[model samples]
Target chain A: MSSRVRKIRENAYVMNTIGIAVFIALWWLAVEARLISPLFVASPLAVVQVLFTQTASLAQNTYITLVTLVESFLVAAAIGILAGAVTGAFDVADWVISPILDLLRSVPNVAWVPLAIIWFGIGIESQIFVSAFSAFFPIFTNTYVGFKSVRPSFIRAGYNLGASDRDVFFRIRLPASLGQVFPGLKLGIQNGMAGLIAIEFLDSTSGLGFMMGEASDFFKANIVIMDMLMIGLLGFALTMTLVLAEKRFLGWQRRTS
Target chain B: MAQGNSVLEVKNLTHVYTDSRSHVETEVIDNVSLSFQEGKFVCVLGPSGCGKTTMLNIIAGFIRPTSGSVVFEGKEVKSPSPERAMVFQDYALFPWLTVSGNIQFGLMMKNTPAKVREAKVTEYLEMMGMKGFEHKYPFELSGGMKQRVGLARALAVEPKMLLLDEPFGSLDAQTRRTMQRELFRIMAQAKKTSIFVTHSIDEALFLSDRLIVMSARPTRVLIDIELKSAKPRQRSDKEYSEVYEKVDKVITAEVSKSIE
Candidate 1:
């Protein structure tokens, strides 16, 4: 088992190296041919220089963006999961709340920026609200579906074993539904981050999106490219961390499936 | 028939399911009456779609009958209780839980204390010959192993009765035979009143003290044969063949009639 794991790790490293090398080669060729104007898309070398030159400020901006994104995601996830679980478990709750959730989800996150600014003002709160709104729907829908779709046999088994309604929900239904909802949660967080960045680009005065907007306005294409790279890198890192956490926490689920 | 020792009594039970789209009321079980004696192994045998499973569900109180009642130990069953546990054909072991966890689930539901629940789980695990597989999840185990876990889970509760819905129907022939033997040994030891539903003729004859044969859809009891064999019944005995032939003839006729 150890040897197999080691081989898999080595293969992953090699694949990453091959991917980066190919990407760098393509970037170099594009720059040499001037296929992408320097005004719009800076050269790889220029972007790297900008990365070092603005490292401190860039890191600070990235930190701000990360904090806001994480806060929004955690809040949305907590609310969505709790509401979805309650609604899914109770028929009256589902009847009362599902339509309202659907209405909220219908309005796009970017469209909420104007109202969010009026309500929470142009700050982290507004951005967080936008992110939370963006994330809420998928997680809610997935969790509701997951809870509702649990097999009748399982519920019956629990009941026959003398489980109370509450016991059934907590012990059997919640854990079973997690198998379906976790993927949705991951997707919701990713989309929420994207939505946060979009809102920031349109309205915010700080964070990675604001940094990129400022660089674009000044025609500092390299700095703009660096910010975009930072966004991608951060998103990738966060998603990987979540996936790792899922694998660790849900090892029993993996073993079962 | 044993007198005044009935563990389960189903009287004139009927169940009708109404389709939402078609607005058609289909009667699954029609005016069925049966009584199971305490500590007896009774097998309900019938063809597919004969509502054998519906009968089991009604007895388990998983579904309400459209008419009549299922009385358990002189009390009418309104809802599922731990006194009656079911071992489903699919082995319905919670996919998220390990084998030990599944077995302990019933004890937990009954609010059995931690130490007692652990002891019961351990005992049943050993009885099921699944001692080392307690930590393995349902998906990691074979179909036979999963069934054993289901059986252990059911047994751990020490219910007054057990309901088995074709427990070995999904297994291969060899595994099915092995499981059947194992089931017999477990039932003999526990002496729990059991209602087993199966379509297999030999299986019913081999395992049951009394076999109730039913007609296909809109099912009703066609024949109830009492096997008077002593303990450790010999499959090749003349009396066993006689009982088998009697049930086989009745079921074959009923099946053909239903098809026509």
Candidate 2:
């Protein structure tokens, strides 16, 4: 609200506007000159026209993609965080899970799409499984680190203040780990979005990924470009929503970096 | 087992830590015996790594000595119990809790009724001179303020004993002196038996009813003395200087011995 801050913010917006305009102008010029094939890459104007023409179906598919992304992420976050904490707390559990986790995490979750499809068939279950699979590793690892890396002094203080082990876990351990956990959750959501798109493109009869794939198959370059932009914007908006919520809830955290 | 005579008694306490890989054992505290009288202020002063904090940790039941017993009243100390509360050097004020909540944490652990918890929190908040900042989180406060909340939290539980591990070590000199005065005031008001660990001779001299000095590891008691004091003890006064000089020389000799 201060004049100085407002002036700097306005200057930043002006610079961003110039950068975006330059990119669009170059893209438009490339299409106009036919340096890139019009049969593949669409012009910005054509993409806008396609967005307007297919507004109803585009909105419907976007909604479906958004829901699948959220539901899968919620499931992954709940299960991953709980399991991560348990494994982190007990050395025996950590040792038991370590070798399998090492093998599984190295292989990208999107590569599990074939396995998911075979197990769940062509239903929404496949999309959810694929999305949750993509999300689980990052969230689990981060949550485990959060539990493991809690300062010994904090735990000692908890015990000195008469907290039971159960109380310490619920109160200190969980909140102390929350700083790292939020970043993991954000990364997990992004990975979840990637998996949702992959499964939807390959198997789902509906959603933005299917729309983009269908458009590409028909060689509707404008529709493909519009769908791509919508997906990018959806990912951006959802991630920013999480960032804002993190700020609101974890306002007390003083980041070292 | 004379419960009325001493609030805490540690009998021939010894601790040895074995390095995991090297299989070498280092004795931290060597055959030390001491007792804390009821409602007395006790200071344990030593060099940086001289196991004074370890001694306090043992008394507070965070650690069990490898070969001896620590009795609180008549009960043997096995684990950290509500009867002994600690204030750490780093303050250790919970980051997520507001000032009021941190102070109430002990009472919450005790499962005190909501009404009493609220009243007790307000009482300690005012006692620590932290009235209006009850809702402010730890990150919002300055170092001295955070330690005040830490003190408030420790004392709120009304523990039979208080353990302070260099509680003012992080503060600037002026703030440290101010906290020392505040600590004296709080201790006088509460009348809890306190075990304070510090390296500063003046801090040990000014605050203690009994001061115990320790040598470097394997640590052993170097000097134990009781003081006669009329507090608001002026630091610049002749008697204060005399005691300070004596304590300083004793601790400095130990520090030099450690280096040699």
TM-score on alpha carbons, each prediction: 0.95, 0.95
Q: Give the Cα lDDT of each candidate.
A: 0.88, 0.89
lDDT of 1 by residue, B1-260 (tens): 36449888999998898899999998888899998888788989998878999999989999989999999989999999879999999888998888889999988876789999878878988888888887888889888999999999998988989999999989999999899889988887788889999999888888888989988878888898787887456779787888788888988887898789
Q: Measured against the native two-chain assembly using Cα atoms, what DockQ does each of the candidate structures obtain, in the order listed?
A: 0.68, 0.65
**Compared with the true structure, what per-residue lDDT tens digits does model 2 show for residues B140-175?**
888899999999999999988889999999999999
Supply the TM-score of chain A against the true chain A for every candidate structure.
0.92, 0.94
lDDT of 2 at B113: 95
What TM-score number comes out for model 1? 0.95
CAPRI verdict on model 2? medium
Off by over 4 Å in 2: A254-257, B1-4, B20-24, B235-239
